[model samples]
Target: MPTLHELPGLAGQRLGPTQWREMTQERVNAFADVTEDHNYIHVDPERAKASPFGRTIAHGYLGVALLAPISQQLLAVEDATGVNYGMDRLRFPAPLPVGERFRGTAEVAEVTEIKGGMQVKVTLEIEVDGQERPALVADCLFRYYA
Candidate 1:
């Protein structure tokens, strides 16, 4: 974890590979219920088998939603107010198959001084276990107020 004082100088630093987290069917179903996005490819295993993936997969947004928590393991700045500014680009190039484990890696692309703090641009990557391609990639902006 980097300290608040260290944030500015930490630009271009590579943080993560956080501990792997398994994607379980229960979590996928819960996400589906919350978002009301019970797509067959995401929630119905039997039906998905007939589709290309051969099994149910997780929603892309679920991978995005996990970024903050996953990045927490990579970076922590206390005594600061942080807000998710947004993402410049996001992609789910590969499927996140159910029951597979995934992890995230973060890189501080840029950090610039703002009115009361700094705006950090982070490139976050979520990789599935035993897979060559990342499940998700996002270029995110975060404003941290000191």
Candidate 2:
């Protein structure tokens, strides 16, 4: 992990395509249950089988939510506490079909000074294993306090 002070110097640094994680039906169902987003394409396998994707798909927001844990593996400030600031941009270029494997990668896009902290913008991508397009791509912001 890099310290908060080192953030500015690490701009443009590319981080890991972390360990693959499977998108299971159980996981999707849990996310749907919590978010009250039980969309048929996400929770109904039989109905989803008739959709273009051929099976249930994970919600796009689920991929966004995953950035929390995924970013931990990619970037961390050893002596600072980090909080999500917001996202400048987000896109789901490909559907994340349940049962598919995915992983995350990040790049330090920018860093700027702020009161008692540094604001960092990271470009994160959640890629489906063996797929040509990423399931999620976002410019995520964070505030790291010393």
Candidate 3:
């Protein structure tokens, strides 16, 4: 992993592609339970099978949920203290269908060193199955401190 200092200079640079295991129905159902989003499109495979995408489709938020593991793979930070400062301009343009292999690209957008920590903002572009339209786009903010 590149050092945090190296990251600032890489602003607007697309990080390497980091993939996640295919989003599964079981996982989706689990998220629905956790988030209380039991929408048929996301939970009912039989019903979702009749939708435009066909088969159970993943929840839009689920796309965002994939960020942590993917980001962990991209940034090898040697620190234990990191906090999510929040996100900006998050959008889910397309649905990620179940069983599709997904990946994310993180581009450094901005960084600022504050009294408490370093504020890092990254534009996360997540996609599935090499599709032209990204499944999700989010400007994520995170803070890290030694």
What lDDT tens digits, residue by residue, belong to model 3 across residues 1-146? 65655545666777868855688889999999999999899998888878887888888888888887767776555643567778988998888888888888888788787675577888887788867798899998877675
For candidate 1, report its TM-score: 0.96
* Cα RMSD (angstroms) for every candidate in the order listed: 1.0, 0.7, 1.8
Number of clashes found in candidate 2? 0
Clashing pairs in 2: none
lDDT of 2 by residue, 1-146 (tens): 88888899989899998999999999999999999999999999999999999999999999999999999888889999999999999999999999999999999999999999999999999999899999999999999998
- Which candidate achieves the best lDDT against the true structure? 2
Q: Model 2, stretches more than 4 Å misplaced? A: none
Error of 2 at 43 (Å): 0.6
Best-first order by lDDT: 2, 1, 3
* Models ranked on TM-score: 2, 1, 3
TM-score each candidate. 0.96, 0.98, 0.89
Comparing 1 and 3 on TM-score, the stronger one: 1
Question: Model 1: how far is 34 from its true place, Å?
Answer: 0.7
The per-model lDDT (C-alpha) reads: 0.89, 0.95, 0.79
